[model samples]
Target: MNTKRLSNQGGESQHQMTARFTNKVVLVTGGGSGIGRSTALAFAREGATVVAAGRREEPLAETVKLIEARGGQGSAIVADVTRGDDVVRLVETVVARHGGLHIAFNNAGVLGTPQRIGDVDEATWSEVIAINLTGVWLSMKHEIAHMSRNGGGAIINMASIFGVHKSAPMYGAYAATKAAVSALTRTAAREYIAQGIRINAVSPGPIEAPMSLRPGETEAQRAERYRETVPLGRIGLAEEVAAAVLWLASPESSFIVGHDLVIDGGVTI
Candidate 1:
């Protein structure tokens, strides 16, 4: 088992973490940065042999480097989730290279430039749907195929509070896709649970990421906004969300399927 001390991400530090995923293989899409990267590291810390997948190779490699530094096994695989061929090849490659994919975090998504439903351009809407919604579906389509036949696995998709809990004006494109993702996750969960696959989602609010900031909003400004609006008095951390992701993927959550776990610091309440 690989053990490591995880640093605090805008919250208390974990002095030591247990190896809950020893001998397991985890595949994390969008594992290049923010919540994705944090979740990748969190899985590695718990002893999963992690495969960090993204379109960009450099950032994915950097994530693997961090995992290695903590004495965990990890590698980077470049693939665009929107491409069916890429998604298929990615799942095959992980299984070919890593033995088996025990868990998957389908976290690839984009926050399309904020626009009202009536004002959104075709390109903007298409891009958001392609990446945020289509990408997840494609990833899951292949993942479920493999897991269902080969002793099943847990799958976690990324959703957001804006769609699942509260929708803001001028963010129609993103909200629509996320709400759709939640719907897909719930439907697919029931469809595949009989086959041993557990599907779930995490809907996060204002985490400490670039996507959380509004246009022309500074970090301090965003912080202040959340401080005033969120009941927790601040935005959530990437690690905080990552922790939830890991739990959803862990054995502890064996019975939690079709559930959208919200981690928004009470803003959605």
Candidate 2:
């Protein structure tokens, strides 16, 4: 008989467990800034090689710098998620370099011109739908194909709190697209769970990010409104949302499938 005793130092064991992602390959869209950026860095810190993709090269490069600064492997790829061809090439490049794609954070998004349903034009509506909803579908389409080739993988779509519940007035398009994302996530999860792929979504509330606030709105106005609406009495940080995404991507969430993990500061309640 063979016997082994557990280590007495829990801290060391915790560090070892947290490094569970060592050598895994992860691809993050919109990884240049905000929640995506934080998630990318968090994955790298846990020992995964990161592929950060985005429209701008500068922010992507900055993310790579942070990853490298922490002694993790990282590379940047510039691509627009709204284009099918771009998404295809993005996955292809990751496979070419990393051999396989194990995890993906489909986080790229845009807040299309906010206009009432009566005043919004067809072009604006189409554009918002293209990026917010279709973009996620396209990325998942290619990501699933690649991951299937390698047995299995995990995918986390960046949905919003609006995906579960609607916000009235001018947010018609944004809310609709996010709700579509939730439906899409469930569909993908059902279709692929048998094939070893796990798909889930992280719906965040009004998080504090550059993209969350309008350009002309003053901080005071935004803060006052957010405080009133959020039960936590404050807006959420990008890192807080990133933590939820990390859980979805890890093995710890193996039993969770097709679920929208809401991180809304109790606003929905």
Q: TM-score for every candidate vs. truth?
A: 0.94, 0.90
- Candidate 2, pairs of clashing residues: none
**What tens-digit string does per-residue lDDT give for candidate 1 at 1-269?**
11112324322244144579998999999999999999998898888999999999999999999888877789999999989999999999999998998899999999988667999999999999999999999999999999998999999999999886997788898999999999999999999999999999999988877688888999888878988988988777788889999999988998899999999888877
Q: Tens digit of lDDT per residue, candidate 2, span 1-269?
A: 01011211122332232476887999999999988988888788788999999999999999999788767789999999899999999999999998889999999998777679989888889988988999999999999998887889999998888766647467788888999999999999999998899999999988877777876987567767888988888777777787899899999999999999888889898
In angstroms, give how far residue 179 of model 1 lies from its true place: 0.5
Question: By TM-score, how accurate is candidate 2?
Answer: 0.90
Candidate 1 wrong stretches, greater than 4 Å: 1-17
Give the clash count for model 2: 0
Q: Distance (Å) between predicted and true CA of 263, model 1?
A: 0.8
- 236: Cα error in model 2, Å: 0.4
> What does the lDDT read for residue 112 in candidate 2?
73
Winning model by lDDT:
1
> Each candidate: how many clashes?
0, 0
